[model samples]
Target chain A: MLQFSFWDILSNLLIATQWTIVLSLIAFVCGGVVGLILLFMRVSGVTPLEWFTKGYIEFFQGTPLLMQLFLFFFGIALFGVEVSPWMAATLALTFWTSAFLTEIWRGCVDSIPKGQWEASSSLALTYIEQMRYVILPQASRIAVAPTVGFSVQVVKGTALASIIGFVELTKAGTMLNNATFRPFLVYSLVALIYFCLCYPLSWGAKKLEGRLNVAR
Target chain B: MTYKLQFAELLPYWDVLLQGLIFTIILTLVSTAAGIAVGTAGASLRTFGPKWAGAIVTTYVELIRNTPFIVQLFFIFFGLPAAGVMLSETTAAFLAMTINLGAYSTEIIRAGIQAVPKGHVDAGVSLAMTKWEVLRHIILNQAFRKIYPALSSQIIIVMLGSAVVSQISAQDLTYAANFVASRNFRNFEVYLLAALAYLLLAMLTRSLLRGLGRVIFKAK
Candidate 1:
């Protein structure tokens, strides 16, 4: 077996970090968009939409993300269309993230007082208008901390993409560990890198949560 | 353009699948209990331990929280043996999972413990209850009641996260699926069947936890 140098491992990890970030950004953005739609559908006046959204949330939330990733990777192919690992990972993460994000944002939106909806409606605003002008703005404030917090989950989740052959930090660590035959040191470094990436956001989320609690 | 779906091909493997399911359940149960124990200790350290201890706990929680479980598993299974702490693949997988679940559960349970009202503790003290007594009879009980939902949810997450162990070849449900798929070259069908099995298992576990919670927390 060829021995990998420290510099080689570091450089490879750095390269893999880009994929992690890219995967995270894609998942977050796509999840945000889908989550918004699910949120509205969840609370929308239409009954079928509400039920459908609830089922969607439960189905994704109930199952393991690994299974979801596998389903997307292989499930789609079973129907005769081929998808790359990146595409499969993105789709799975986006769907998984959206389910949880919808729930989080729904809680935020629900925490807004019932009176605001009535007050906006009294001002001759339509339902969409009221949401646009009043409810969403207030809800968005409450949403910020949790949203940022959930992004940390998204970041951590990108690691699962590695299972399906999407090479990210975790996958890179495996490669390095295989070559160096040094599991503990490599994984400790991997954990440290992840801590560096996640701790700041966790701190920020806590700070924001504290401020929000005070404001309330 | 027309490949017929074959359910019959998978029927003979039902016995293997059933065994795989049982193993998955056993793994989940063992890890969940072990995780709760580790988590409770970690949570107590954060809540009631000294400064340095709290800092250590904080560092551990953050480290486990940030990194991926797959990496952690690889380190334990593949990494530790290199350092002379050799363990079987299954043992290593379980140990890694216990630690990972412990860190996350520590945070959840800590939040639950902190959510207990100050008045309750004061009341316990006024009744001449010792610190340990207050913690056990009053504070801890109430905290568990409050955090049961979060704890249950975290347990499910742990169960799901357990799937990562397959990478270390633990012969769990996912590993079985991987093996069956390779043997039959029916990757999609095998995984699809495995996904259904996972979904059923998740639902079953959730209901079981819910029932247990109801039985334990009669007031709830």
Candidate 2:
């Protein structure tokens, strides 16, 4: 068994932390774009589009992220496409994040009272204009907390990418634990790092949730 | 890409899949029950206990919430053995899952408890109810009614998360899928079947929770 120093494990984990952050950003940005489109499609009131978006959300949300990662990693290989672990991880995460973010944003859009839409329609605003000017502006206020809250899930979800050999924080922890033969110590540090990354967002989410509750 | 989607390859593995499904269900139910117990205790401590107790529960919640479940699972499964606390993969997976579900449920249930109006508690107090009685009859019940949907959703998510335990060779659905896929060399078909199985499981769990909510809360 390979032996590793404490500093060596820490440094490796620190380096791997960058990948975790980068992957999260990539997944967040791409998922945000796709999620926005999905939200629009869901609210467009087109039956097929609604069904398609719903199906997309359910497919990702209903299944485990680990299975999705496995499918992307191994399933794509069968089609004669040489996909890297990074590509597969990113694709799975982006799709998964998009499904959730779409549902989240759609709830935000829906939470705007019906009277706002009716009033906007009475003023002869097109659907696009109403969304751009009236609906979204108000909806965004309600959306902020849940969106921020969901980011915590995204960060945690990125840990699943390590299963496909993406070498993020969790994967680094596993490697270090293997070398050091100290599972609890290595994992506690890993958990600590993740807590540092996630707790502020959790606190912020709670704070925003409180503000939202008080506002209503 | 000339890949044909042949699900027929998975036909023989239906029994294995069923076994995996049963295991998955058992794991979910056990963890969920254990989780609720932990969550209730944590939430109560956080809400009404001394300062140190509240702080400790808060710390536990944050630690579990932030870390990846897989890491948590590894720590329990692989790490514990190093400390001479060996457990089978299934037991470790179940323990990690219960702990994870407990933390999230604590937060949700705490919110539910807090959402119970002060007047309800005051009324319970005025009726000569002891603190424990008031907590049981008023606060806890009302919180459950309010948080049932959120709790149920979390339970379904936890069930989905059980797939990760396959990494430790727990023979959950994902493990079975991995086995069938490698044996049949039909990776796409096996996963598609697995995904459908998961989807069906999710639907079934949700409906069951809905029925449960109706029975428990009388709100359906």
- lDDT tens string, model 2, A1-216? 556777877888889999999999999999999998888889988899999999999999999998898889978887899989899999999999999999999988998889999999999998789889998899889999999989999999999999889999999998887777788788878888888888899889989999999998
Task: State which docking tier applies to candidate 1.
Answer: medium
lDDT of 1 by residue, A41-148 (tens): 886778999899988988888777888898899777777888898999999999999999999999988898989988988899987787788988999999999999
Query: Tens digit of lDDT per residue, candidate 2, span B60-171?
Result: 9988988889889988898788788999998998899999999999999999999999999999999999999999999999998999899999999999999999999998
Off by over 4 Å in 1: A1-3
| Candidate 2, residue A167: lDDT | 91
TM-score for candidate 2, residues paired by index: 0.96
